[model samples]
Target: MRKPRRPDVTTLELVGGAEALELELHSYDERWASSYLEHRRRISDTPMAGKIEIQHIGSTSVPGLAAKPIIDIVVTVDDITAEEDYLDALVDAGYELRVREPRHRLVRTPARDVHVHLFEHDDPAVDDYILLRDHLRSDAEDRSLYENTKRRLLSKRWDDMNDYADAKTDVIAAIKARARAARGR
Candidate 1:
């Protein structure tokens, strides 16, 4: 089980400064799946459609899990460094490039309700995302634990949404560890 590295904030080229936004978690909604499908269709219509792998990830992907009402999509391409191959297409599809870091790039809708994460095809982070989502979907205890962790963190005032995400790293790691162990990894 390879751990995903969190890039230093200084290394990230952010198009928009981390804006102060109220963080609120919404109950699991079936519409999240529909939202992901709609976005998937939009992405599949792009030129790189057949060449990339797209998946719905994060809390929103798990049924019964509360999430921040944002659809998280992961796209794996042959080379993340070659943004020219896919970035422009995504931007043209109505997404704004938000975060660009080594081996990763993030684009989201202007409304901030949908985030698309780009990575290299072989990146372990992709597996981590799927594993965590699968685990949460199948394990009731871990699902509750994760939800509780998010709710607890929600009480704190976060200057940036990334800070709120960073706060959940520990709990997420723990859950992933258990997930890996269960798989005999």
Candidate 2:
């Protein structure tokens, strides 16, 4: 791991107006699942995989949510702070470091539609994401509720994508808590 360069102007410019954009709803289709898995597999085969573990996550991975048509991949590494040399691999792989959200994780993308997350395993929030995704998969009621909320949100005008994501925090937190309690945590 080497020291990371300070984000260049392009990276800074890309992190613009974090608003919740309107969500586009699509029927629960096998294509989304298929595409997501295929993309995940392709990403995993990349050289980046030697340094990162990739997982398909987000609403699209949930199987039945009305979501934006982007496949989200969460990639975990040993230390994000140390991956300076590997950042170029992502760029060469056609990804843009859109958000340098050092607080949670440094999220990037090979494209705008799909987000490819980069995180250090030391970050607990990555675990949260994995757990929440697992919980949604296990609980049918939770899945239904998520789909309903997604439909309602998609029907509205959002300031940007962040607003829509922020709206789901309450329900997501509730479901996470329920899952933990049920597991006797």
Q: After best superposition, candidate 2 residue 161: deviation in angstroms?
A: 0.9
Per-residue lDDT over 19-91 for candidate 2, one digit per residue giving the tens place of the 0 to 100 score: 4454587765667678777767766666653456777787777766556787778877755654554466676
lDDT of each: 0.90, 0.68
lDDT of 2 at 10: 29
Q: Given candidate 1, what's the lDDT at residue 10? A: 39
Reference-based lDDT, residue 16, model 2: 54
Per-residue lDDT over 1-185 for candidate 1, one digit per residue giving the tens place of the 0 to 100 score: 23334332338887878888888889999999999999999998888733799999999999999999999999998777667789999999999999998778999999999999998788888999999999999999999999999999998889999999999999999999999999999
Model 1 misplacement above 4 A = 1-10
- The C-alpha local distance difference test score for the whole of candidate 2 amounts to 0.68
